[model samples]
Target: MKKTFKVVVDCDDVLFDCNGYAVTKLNREKEYAYKKEDITAWGELGCGLDERLIYFRDPVFVRDMPVLPKAREFIQALSRRAEIFIATSVAAECAGERVSSIIRNFPEINPENILIGTRKDMLKADMLLDDCPDHIRSAEVTYPVLFRQPWNLSVSGVISTTTYREFLTLVDMVQKPEPEMDPMSPVVLVGPSGAGKNRVATALEETGRYRRVMGYTTNAGSRAFYRCVSWEQFHYKRNDFVETSSYMGEMYGTCREDVESVFREGRIPLLVMDINGAVNMRLEYGARIIFVSAGKEECIRDILSRGLPLEETIRRISSIDGEMKNETLCDMTVSGTGFRVSSLEKTP
Candidate 1:
């Protein structure tokens, strides 16, 4: 049987040859020959200030451009197995043009699923296919793939494919005869206090396929999942951490060495943090964000069992509402109850 996953794709270079189309149009008008390789950067495309806006902002230019080779065919094939979304970043001027074109050309995509926004990081899906390195790196999805283009060929540390057919085969997520994994990215877990995130992380470690990363912290009272440090020591070694945060006036952070050592040992790094910490780490790790939740009532009940002081318990409880809102933004959400290795194994 084949595996399925949600995929959000970009418009400019992934699905349609927007840049290439502009190049062709410019060359035709100027009677100059410019190949795709010549466009290593937007500035190199030889468009002046006014010209760039006129070309990319025009509805006709967007709607009539030829689709990238095999993009339509592979997308149609993928629709049979996945929940496909067209998440394109465009100006409001031509947003409708992009949407109308997709609706007319790809009937497999629901019109309601076409998303127009520049904040691609806010879009939740298992995978995201985009040509921009900034967009790919910011995505908190399980599989943030770079759709290779002449400009993005040199970008490193992300999974990439050169063609639509190759992308289709690459995201065949699990249980296939030759399924593969990209060990470059870490699997990050986030939840509110008393959400049983620690329990879930421990379960992943017991599988022996993952190593729970030990974060460094200045929380003097903390004894688990962290190596406590003095404030002076933390300030001295501040550069060593990839991300840091404060909770109830206690500082915590994940060290670079902790995550890299797990990679060198051939085990995936598992991190349990708050939402902000997880998103901050994605700048370099491309980490897959999973929001582990046990619901508000259950979380409060669990916190009370810990026998914490009244003020501290109240502080944690107040943050529950804000933490719950992040569930929909993460790549995946799993109940803390009975969550096991299989939950992590189900995706790419």
Candidate 2:
């Protein structure tokens, strides 16, 4: 079956030529003449004309403005593949004029799909194409695409598009399938400290099928191998990391940028983390978690062979029972003994 995306599109700068209309109105009605390129700031109007007065109070101008270039054609094409909604906000007095303008210009759009409200973030959508920063920041489910405008050029982290054609290209990038040789979803291998999880992760990385994402750690010995940040830095920038946990007197975390970077490069990120970190990740982003175990006896023996104190070995082994119970939480479970990449053939 084909996948259908739920897309919410904005109207002002995205579909309607709001800026052009404002410029024309300002030049014709107001004392100071202004061009489209001259109005660079978001809500700025030349000759001290307020945006609210021009956009909201003027009903005749809102009703007669032209639709944005190529907007009607793009929306018509997009409606065939995705469930499209026109999400816009306007003054209560001129709401009818805005709706009528859309209906008169674009007959393809269903009147039921027209949504007019001040808070677009409350709408449920998979993706949002808008030019407003406040709307993008407040959005809950939609991945924002800042439709190119001089006002929103400084916004960060969200995708941006200069034209409707470029927007279609970005949509294709998000929905296109990866190569047949590439693995599907990113993998997170979770196990106890002494269960050879790192060794298994290394083997999978060596296969060239996965990109190993090193989590942040404060351990002095592991600083060179993994991405290491100070405990204070981690605390100060907590939101930068996807998941974090304290274990064995050191802090470890998975950086959100690392996972997104790997995904942007069209590769699956293979992460090695403890059960606590894995559970936290599952709660946040719903990662594909795999539990790796080598049985209780083998785990204790392996910790002892590393020359650690018996007390530490027992302490690590004591946590095995809790970790084993997490098997029910994972998508798949595999034995760590003699593990190979073929073991993951059945994985999605």
Candidate 3:
């Protein structure tokens, strides 16, 4: 069963492009060239007068301001797995206009979920996503997430994220999983590079019965979904990693928090890792390890076809032999060519 989280998201800069629209409006109407990045503080429009007189009171700004990029898409996606509520602090007079804009832009959100007031802390929820530090600090009971804003950049100690995708990741991390009679154990999918482990992991995730525990990596290509951390950050949080390994001069590690988060969501946590990381997970957490193999010849062919440097290809080929030596430690063995969901059945 999937866990449902009561997510309370703030309006203004979070959902609506308030600052972006304000900057554009000021630039156009007031003959001021104010850029979006220049308005770092709330209500303090670098130009002398507070933003209320210039922007908020304007009917056009209140009713027709554009939604932030990807706001609608992510909110819709999150609503499928969790209950979403919009909590804002717009003025009473303009609240109706803001609500109308929200209804027009996001019809999937129920009108009742649109909360307008200053006292967001009064509402009950599992998590609070807002840009204002005051609002986050005020909501003492709910898990406060400081949504990324130039104004709140200096604030610390709360989970902060810049994008809606990152917000969803944090939501999944916080919600506890539902209890189950036949609870699924955490799974570590191990194999040589290009040996079809990632393919199998993706298939399992698509089944909606598994959640991929995204690992931190230095690889630039995987930075979109994978957590990208600096060398300093990796060292600072080294102890939190359940498993860590180096590949092609880059470091990768699975954080313990991500794994626990997936388990809390009542879905199997799937990890695709190298043999070294696999050994570490098995030793540290007794994680269910599955050895995925495509035979030595096929592994080499796949690696070479991927256009990796010959040296790296050879290194991967050599590592496969060492990985296969640890096959005895795995709970299950799956051939890369014959990968199937049935092969994942729990051993008796």
Candidate 4:
């Protein structure tokens, strides 16, 4: 099946003759003819090498320059199937003129789509065309098409198009795929204490794929755990803070309010849980359960070394190694001994 997508075009070199304007600006001011290598010299002029890009800021730069060969026709054709956004970056001082030049080129282009910032990181366009190497590198995060310019020959690991038509051809060859995710289900991870349950969650958060839901508890908080409740709330009078299976004079329950808070933030919530809580959540929400474990001796040693009580540590070791129905609740078991938080992964 053919894939449909939104398109964003870059103004400078891909659609407009920016290099020609840059050459003209230098010649008019310096009384010298422009050369391709002269581009580097522009960066070296006034206010260090950075100030040279300021020449593109002049409104006349875009007004006087002609559209790149066939640039206008290609954009008009692509606009039929895609919502085209003209995403570009120009000097801040001349933003008004730069935007004016853009609108003058394509009378129908939306002013909202005309961007003027360096944080190409914030842009969410499907395709971008420019001559600069750094702009291409930044757009890779979202798989946007990057048109090659003379300045980008030194960049690596990037696919480049030399012309606007070639870019359209490139996007046509490779389809932009939509993501598949279970609408009602979130990616769930479960593991024993120190088995790296929270560690794996931390890793996922870094990738911007999932969100961490602080597991609620009735027990006194521990800093080692990813999220913990303060003693004040643990001692607060509430039925939700009751014990799971009375071992001594302690209570263990997942704080429903906290978990829900994470969901409210519009991200897939990740919760660390004891076997009882993990299983309960699985039954209630049918959440994906990941069981993390370690050998009896190794687990016990780790538990104690982290300052867990000896009696409590021994109790956990016995249950994990014993023949118990709870052991079957895990969807996946990952080795936790000497576990590096960064190495955790989910089995597909």
What lDDT does each candidate get? 0.75, 0.70, 0.72, 0.55
lDDT order of candidates, top first = 1, 3, 2, 4
Q: Return the top candidate by TM-score.
A: 3
lDDT of 2 by residue, 1-348 (tens): 866688888988899888877767766766566566665456654645554345655778678778888888998887765788888887777789999988887787789999988788788877788989788767774456667575565443344555676566445434542212224566789776577787787878887667888778776556334767787887776788777655555667788898888888876788887654554554445566787977888887787787766755666777675566545546677778878778875444
Overall local distance difference test of candidate 1: 0.75
User: Which runs in model 2 stand beyond 4 Å of their true positions?
Assistant: 1-4, 44-52, 179-348
Q: Which residue pairs show backbone clashes in model 2?
A: none
> What is candidate 4's CA lDDT for residue 222?
41
lDDT of 1 by residue, 32-83 (tens): 6766766665333454322444688788898797888877887788797688
Per-residue lDDT, model 3, residue 11, is 85
How far out, in Å, is residue 34 in model 2? 2.1
RMSD to the hidden true structure, all candidates: 12.2, 13.4, 16.1, 21.9
Off by over 4 Å in 1: 1-4, 42-53, 175-348
Candidate 4 residue pairs in backbone clash: 43-49, 191-292, 216-255
lDDT of 3 by residue, 1-348 (tens): 855568898888899988778777766776776577665566555563354355776666799888898888988988876888888888777888999988898887889999888997797887788999788777854566767676665443344566676566545434522222233767788776667787788777887888888889776655334788887888788889876655555667889999888878878888887544654554445567787877778877887888766766677776675556545546668877777877775433
Q: Using alpha carbons, what is the TM-score of model 2?
A: 0.50
Backbone clash numbers for all candidates listed? 0, 0, 1, 3
